[model samples]
Target: MAEVTTSPRTWSPAAAPPHAPHSGGPRWRVVVGSYGFRLTLVVLLALAAAVGILTYGNPAAPGSSGFWVIVRSRFASVGTILVVAFCQGVATVVFHTVTNNRILTPSILGFDALYRVIQTALVFLFGAGTLAATDGLGKIALQSLLMVGFASLLYGWLFTGTKANLHLLLLVGVVLGMGFGSLSTFMQRLLTPSEFDILSARLFGNISASDASYLPWGALVCVVVGTVLWRRRHVLDVVALGRETATSLGVRHQREVLLTLVLVAVLISVSTSMVGPMTFFGFVVAMLTYQVVGDSRHTRTLPMVAAVACATLLGAYFVLRHVFYAAGLVSVIIELAGGLVFLVHLLRKGLR
Candidate 1:
């Protein structure tokens, strides 16, 4: 038998002092400690090894002399994947955090659609051959800048409002994406079959031989935009808590959100321009990262986890394409897998 006695002072909640900071944890603990980060890091490291295998251990290359060729090709492919992964991951995470919803991707907000519209209009205004002949780097830069300008305009309205509701903002974004899609479709219908074929390929986010030439410019844009997002990672943590809560905590919520939106647009535009439109990659990466990390703070969790996931997926695709498939558009396969995940996520959300 135990005898229990409590003093009146101890029983009073108000009399208790603030909780002391916790200790006795691992001295070299990884910050964020999300399962997503650990898994992503593992996946990315494995992917790097896999790329090494693909580049150096190919049997088809009859001689050791072909290693450099394999290296060059793999280098281009990995570089492009890194850019796309960073662009899509950062953009999707920031966009969802700003809007306070997990279901929405940057594409839902007309980012990808806007890119298509610009591309289509350019082809329509200039003949396809002339457009093709244009400097690829210049096009990527100009396109990204245009996207940033458009994103800034679109988000400016939200800053005027007192609060932004998640569902409402998603509704508006979906509607706008739909509008842009419809306009792109209408424009495509007016083109010749050959021209429409070109448009169709562009619309689906194709990363084929014809599109590889845009890589250098796309890489540059991705690096610039990725740096911008990295600089604002701390601000992202505050923005995730919704507008009012963030503002109450002395964050310049609107300005920061708008700037993030523009950065996201730049990132999306660069990546989309590189490979085409990836409708669900970001949604998949970001949602998985959130679920994996169990924290919304962008500071420790956003770039590291998101970038790793993106790189792993793309790297896996490269391995499969070189090692197994060898005859398909890797982007199509990834988009299909990503779309399925998005649907499952939506169904789960609906059930909840």
Candidate 2:
């Protein structure tokens, strides 16, 4: 006993060294590594693309008054891009969530068909002059109202019963889309060549075609809708876990789906009415977003989707406009690329 106590050991708690927690432990986590890096990289690239588009090949010096004037003129295109990208990106992601299907896009919900019908009918009944004459807030509001109303009615009716089914809703949407397309085609066939030419321009999705006056209103809707979605990200996360899980988590799954569809309809409507129907743009954005985000959680997924969309659009716009001098084909090129990607995805992964 005396020999054992010879060292006179100090057993004070303060004398012990502290242990460091594992870096991978939840208690010690900081950054999200690639998730954060990719997101930040995308955002920076988007900013750079925007700067280039606004400043590149300016006729006047950067500090000159003429340069500022040119930039101001170009700001409309940039604003249009922002509004369209935001609307499409947000709408596509949320649409995927509600349907629990990544392959489907808001375009398939008949917005494009409805938009085409509206434009074609305008030209068919009142002639091509009405297309230009109808370009105002009133027309846009009317278009958005019709689209959203259609969605609300469809969702409300479909999700009302105990056997409320998403696939059935999708089937019905497809059938209706085909019908609308047929109607549009018939109307176009009856129109004169000159009328068809004007109608064709409206049919193609053109970012530059978006009226400057419509940008603010579109952006306002996006801001309000985006605010709602972002604030409810957690709830969306639960909803993404599927209906049973969401209901168990105290969320009203049916109500949420209806609400999400209605909001998505608004977004798609605004973008479609502003820039014509972007059939494959949102599909490609959502597909690429799903591949990049690496997480199903809406919190991380949503922002990443938005950044990727902005970067994609801005980079493509800058290149096609400045480099290729094919500014008018930006939408065409995007749709082509999107279609290729869609076909590839279908061949490889099917409809999951």
Candidate 3:
């Protein structure tokens, strides 16, 4: 009888919460609206225009031999420069995104270091004159591929848990670079005065002397890799969201990361092969792109911004090469400027 007494319970539908109001503008819109972003675009475009003028020439005209030669000579260097810009820019941006940091670059991965060591070994073993007399294109390609293989092996090991901490990977890279530097120094110390001159010439870049013969092959490689990046632009943007999130979104993070590293290696090989290694050049360009873009959207920011930044840097170098360095080294000047920028960045970050 006591169980017969039941309490009345109300049946009610679940209430929906209020929808949030629309934000004033999209993130992209806000980013594009910033004055700094506009200034960056203006400056980059101006620099690109200047580079175009510097590179362009009337080859058919009489007394235009030197001008036309510069024009023709830029074929591979132009492609190499653009490829390096885009690859390094995109690579650095993606790298920073993956690691969630802004200051790192492909150089930190030891790709460039490995490249240096390979070049040094080639000279030390085969002698510098041999490399110079040999087919430069074939030699550059061989060295590039070797560097690529080394980078792939390094990445495979690191990503596959060979290294527990990413920092450890960077530390290893730094140590490897130091080792390479030491080896190069020891080799340089042993060279006779004549041998030293030969080696030193092989060790730096001369845009005017850039062999145009390599243009076709370098262009093909850069086009293929650049196309791959462009086609997978969305995937790159997703990868920038970090591994777990990118994986959750159906982006194959590991595969993409490895592919990116390969692409970066290819770009590095092209640039270094064309002009030797220019330390902090990519760092300056990538940092400028980021500061200009104000967001990490690879679709719009990575390649274009990087190209503009590099064109600008190269244009400045072109002018300075003709002006202050008439007979001096362009690489030395670029390295000097880039080094200063690096120092400034370090100081600013340190202060912060």
Per-prediction RMSD in angstroms? 8.5, 4.1, 10.2
Top TM-score model: 2
Candidate 2 residues 138-206, lDDT tens each?
Answer: 999999999999988998898898988888889999999999999999999999999999999989988
Tell me how far the alpha carbon of residue 193 in candidate 1 is from the true structure, in angstroms, after superposition: 2.1
Q: How accurate locally, in lDDT, is each candidate?
A: 0.70, 0.89, 0.68
TM-score of each: 0.79, 0.91, 0.77
Superpose all Cα atoms of candidate 1 onto the true structure and report the RMSD in Å to 1 decimal.
8.5
lDDT of 1: 0.70
Model 2 per-residue lDDT at 181: 99
TM-score of 3: 0.77
| Ranked candidates, highest TM-score first | 2, 1, 3
Question: Candidate 1: misplaced stretches above 4 Å?
Answer: 1-63, 157-172, 208-224, 326-328
**Residue 332, model 2: Cα distance from true site in angstroms:** 0.7
Model 1 / residue 352 / CA error / Å: 2.0
User: Between prediction 1 and prediction 3, which has the larger lDDT?
Assistant: 1
For residues 1-352, could you state the per-residue lDDT of candidate 1 as single tens digits?
Answer: 8999986644556555554233325422644364555765756674764465446456555456776666666565666676677778777878887877777788877777888888788778785665567647677678778877776766776556767444555577788888888987788778888887766666675443434566677767767776777787777888888777899999987788777777777788788767778888877777777766667777656655555655656665656666676424677767888999989988998899
> With candidate 1 superimposed using the best TM-score fit, by how many Å does residue 176's alpha carbon deviate from the native?
3.0
